[model samples]
Target: MKQQLPKNFKPKALAALIGLTFTLNHASTIAQEAEPETALETITVTAQKRTQNLQEVPVSVTAFTGDEMAEAVIKDMYDLQTNVPGLGAFQSQSATNSSFSIRGVGTSSQNFGLESSVGLYVDGVYRARQNSMINNLVDVAAVEVLRGPQGTLFGKNTPSGAILVSTVTPSHDGGDSFVEATVGNYGLVNLSGATSISAIEDVLAFRVTAFGSQRDGTIDSVGNGSETGKNLLNDRNRWGARVQALYTPNDDVSVRIIADYADIDEICCGAPVQLSNATINPDGEIGSDLALPLLGGTVFAGGDAFYDREVAVSFLPESTMTDKGLSAEVDWELDENYTLVSISAYRNFESFDNIDTDFTDANLFGTYNDSKQSSFSQEIRIDYTGDNLNYILGAYYFTQDLDLDYSLYTDTFFNEFYMSSLGGALDDLFAGINAISAATGGAVAPVADAAPAGTGFDHQAKQQHESYAVFGQFDYELSDTLTLTAGLRYTDETKDLVTIFSENLADGSQSPEFFNSTTELIIGAGAAGVAAGNIGAALAGGQAPSAEDLAALLPFQTAGWGFQ
Candidate 1:
């Protein structure tokens, strides 16, 4: 007979007998009339650079432990808004375009030169860019959201608020591990795991953690192309990993190091156009009457009659991001009442987005952005604790380099539509000129060919930024229930940006006739001492020329309409 492993076995209850004996022996000594006492658990937070009871901190702050976050299924920065009051978070076409607001104060612009008013810090190291702030939370120990201005304590840009994230540290006594998996609708799958080990008993330890999630798109893409009949909008595909190490050779000093990386590649972010009661033409026709024909008879589906979660596109939208960073923190106890700390970090982030600007299958226009940023920062602080006084002093230095290459382009369908419109407008212009010539007895010129097709431009921008600050905060206890708190910060910053624009056409061809006709009309009218308004009235029949129209015409006079 083959040997078989035991499938089910019960061990003897040895602990129960031991417990019974101990209880019998201690029954006479124990007091049966005493009632157990209970008290609320105290929560400790580090919002002021030192640990303190949450109820004792004077700042307007909210904190959540890792267990609370896991119980609530908080996975990333976007999920914090649902649980935190007076906080708003939104991700636009990509992670790089994310926005975070605290009490209705935040930065929403996507300009490469701007910084967020609400600062984000992980392990006491600043995450200067929006892309760096959207990574999945892995092995998080605690999160603290501080409302109102925190410029003195956090430094950099924190005029609105600040978010602080602390990751679990590697412990000398290890043997910690866990694995979790979750599944949901729309083919969603999430998996994460973490493990810790001690390499040198009391001197060194290390921990490794990883997480990933993916879900199918919620919106449908319906078009006459290969992408038709596919759920290709608003999908999720991302993964990340982190490694941490701790070292404490003696009782007075400790060091922690962390390295992390994350990636996101997904087809995302387009909304259906609602045409109900929408106007698109000067004659006040409904938007669908003018837009549906242009979309080649594409119809909306999946929800209401006029509004739904369906998008029609000739090209699918795409967004991808890569974020990686390394940080080191050191803490040393100088004496019984003073401690010194230092944090140094370096990060690199890159994101690319291809979006359909027109939100239709007409292929009118599209935008592409390729951006990269590299940053380095250093902070040093010293803490002083006395019987009735506590204070912290710190200095921070940061530098970054950013590069953006942007392009806007049109296709054949857009070129054809533009040429047709340009031809009709030219016809009307020549008719007015002919009538003027008949009245003035001057020569009438024939209309010219429409301007060159497939017009587009490309530009590359580079920015360098550097900043440094010295900040300090102090608190003094005046009595048992009263305290005085004061803080100050002085910061200096500088930035430099340079942009280079490419020629309109790759072949560098010129449309001289197109420029000549338009420029001649404007210059001839101007040379005759006619006012700009009169020139506009004579050419357009009544309306004054808009600033944009005049700007477009002014460049053609000398530069010949070439983007330089």
Candidate 2:
């Protein structure tokens, strides 16, 4: 309305209208502000020692939360392959150790002088042995699989990668506890129980966890269909517990102690069944024995005589393992920006008479060998860490003393017995030849040589090794998005190898030298005894056999009886 009202009337009416407008707009603004927040949540992880967004960490890492572990059925590092890419695990049937490969770089050698490319650590304490590293890994807060050379911050010999396992620490508030049980295929059963007690309110606390698992075997014996052998190639019954006590007298100072023990009785069985046996061809001609044959006894047609049979056997023993250890550490906050920490640990592990790897041929015509090993390890380290630039300066001293014994049981008796038996049969043929020669009016040949006698090879070797290593690693962040890592280690390895040989000689004085010169040569020469003697004498005198010489000796030595 363009019409002007009395000044008082207009002011009163406008004021009322403005008041109504303010209330409506204020309500609408409040309604708009009350709408819920619509942004996704961000996750933080301690992959670099400091808390940072998971996606922001520059290095490649795979983190598994406790819940994720359960979902994936991951019980330990050996179960890590299901979730982690480019990683695989294999346990040794001949030793109390495991092989972990990352990008195909892990070591397959179980020698005391060698170190694994993949490093394993629990609660910051390095696990020196493979069996010990498989200790009860339950109740873990998270597991971080650090890929690439982790030599920078995690210590030495991690040229391939590293696995860091962290357990849940005790709560300062009045403690809590839980119990759970699980069962699976092949009679699998597992039980775990834990409780935390506030020993001294917020000043001190203790947490204890116990667990057990058992399962039936998965393999059925192929030879005799017997259930007597270990069924599960990797089946085991395990039980263990851990006690961790923490004391925080003040917010600035703290001390912690940890003790653990575990027993693992497993039947490890695995064999490498793939191999190639290469041999030299007899001659340069295409018709030589090296060439593939054809039928109907002709070069162009395939035949049954061309086929060869190949048989292979494996020799490995079942293995069992046990482990126990104790450790402690102290953390002192020197200031908000600086802190110092000291860590000390002690460990003892013994494989006992656990593994037996004698899976070879024990027949009269084959070979058999027995092998076993025992090893002990000890280690100690000290280090430090901080902000912006996080670095660990430490000294690691490691020592291992190991012993290995082996023996070979050959069929020497059977070899000798069979050769004599075969020689008797061959001798009967010689008499027939003499009669045939007399009737035909041809010259009769003398006796043919006997075949080479039993057990062609035999020997044994034993070795002991003592080794030590001192190592360290350094990690530095150049910027907010990039990091530079470097490390080096020195290892001292020593081995004492001994070889012992034996044979069932009727008179202990018989050796390969005497046997080969007389018995072996005579029998192997067959009907060519006289010609072979001359040829052998010429060879002994350093004279080579020429084509002409071979041709001249063929009929007497190799051709007449189809003996070539």
Candidate 3:
């Protein structure tokens, strides 16, 4: 089964929800002996690694307040895009991974080799990959969408831009907690709650927040009215919690620790039925030998051609995914003009095994087990606020390790029977079989052999990456309101990827069929062939191998291209 995300959400309704929730919750926080509302204290932002008025930041940034986020049901990164302009996200038609694009800069291809062009960071910890975007985040303070090139401040392959997420920290405000829930169409339900408490009078505090959501499928299966079997299978469910503790011994110094986890479970995704082009014939023939004439009555007693022409998403699975992570951040104020900050984080994400794509009724494939990926990072920064010249400096370090095990199966007989049933010895193997039946003067078409049972191919890949960067930004008050800012960063990154392929078939012996086949085609035609791998392989191969050659090869393996 295939799935598509809702492109247009109810923006007005989302805004109304956030507005109402914020009004109700904030009404309780209003102070009685309040100082005169001195021009509604402008909200300051520190996203640029420097403190400045939100409006004075020389960048295209969409800042979402906690009030706006609550009103729009913006519990996580996925929901945040609904209100931000020029930003979009979807579970690709390929995997449970989210495809994100800002101003059309994201990768459209589904290959895992290429990560997203946009960087995602939570609490100063860079989310190294895409699967982490699968679930809702808990206790978010604010989300900043920084558009355009940000490599100077954040240099993790974000050719487009980056999303900076900051979560709420524990406060000294004495209080219990509160909870909220939501119900909607498609069995949609959401529950969220949070609370804060002072552990030591004005010295120590702790806060906790959590969220969960679930929904049934909106699409229906046509073959069988089996709604139960498919409803929740294609739906989504996610939940997570965060806890934080803050300690302030004096007015100039503070320490904080925070941890969080998130998970998403939903059937994998599949592409839509868009278009189909005829497979090219190698005999210089425009169509297949089995191609049916216009009349069509002569073939198979007026029935349609034996082969059906349809556009299909080759092999997909009913997939589920889980994402979880933890991180800690600390802030220290040295005197009045100097400050320091440090953050450390770790994250893990994986996708469950299942079949989500239905290429043809004859051949189907599924994932065998969950694929896992993990990463860790640390960063430190120091800044000083000066009257004439303001400056900030920072250094970052990151590491990641990944382990993936996946499988594919071709479990139906129709495909093998259609192409390989004819025996090699005689003009027609069906002749002898029909002759025996003719002895009784009865007529019956020759029978083809039952399609061979499906074959299985599995793969394991391990990847490691390390990166470091040092950056500095300086701002000069050129005039009074006309400030000039400039920044620069130096970064180095290295990646090591190793792939292991193992084949499982009727023979029981393991071979590197899948890897050999794909790599051969990719490396054969040089860069030109590699470029074609981005689109279609058969077209790149040019010379289609015989069915016999293809059958002898590993299932899901390519034949025409040579291995490097």
Q: State in Å the error of residue 243, model 1.
A: 0.9
Model 2 spans > 4 angstroms off: 1-52, 92-97, 174-176, 224-233, 270-316, 352-392, 403-564
Order of all candidates by lDDT, from best down to worst? 1, 3, 2
Residues 101-193, model 3: lDDT tens digits:
787788642345566778888777787667666577555667788888788778887788888877766776634355777676667777777
Model 2 RMSD to the real structure?
20.6
What ordering of candidates by TM-score runs from best to worst?
A: 1, 3, 2
Residue 90's lDDT in candidate 2: 64
* 1 versus 2: better lDDT goes to: 1
lDDT of 2 by residue, 1-564 (tens): 011122222121111110000011110000111224684444455555444556766668888766567667787766787689877676554335567777777876454335578877776666656556664567676788878886545544678888777776666543246566766656667777666778898899888878898776443222211123434444657888889998999998888888888887765443311110112212222433232111101121123211111111222245555676777777777776556666566666555323222222222233232333344344443334556555444444444343433233233223333344445644544454444335435433333222122322344555565555655555577787777766566666666776655543323322233223445434533544444444445555777534453333333222111111
Better of 2 and 3 by TM-score: 3
Best by TM-score: 1
Error of 1 at 415 (Å): 2.5
Q: List the residue pairs that clash in candidate 1.
A: none
- TM-score of structure candidate 1: 0.79
Report the Cα lDDT for candidate 1: 0.69
Backbone collision tally, model 2: 16
Instruction: Give the range of the ten consecutive residues with the poorest summed lDDT in model 1.
Output: 18-27
Give the distance in Å from residue 429's predicted Cα in candidate 3 to where it truly belongs: 6.6
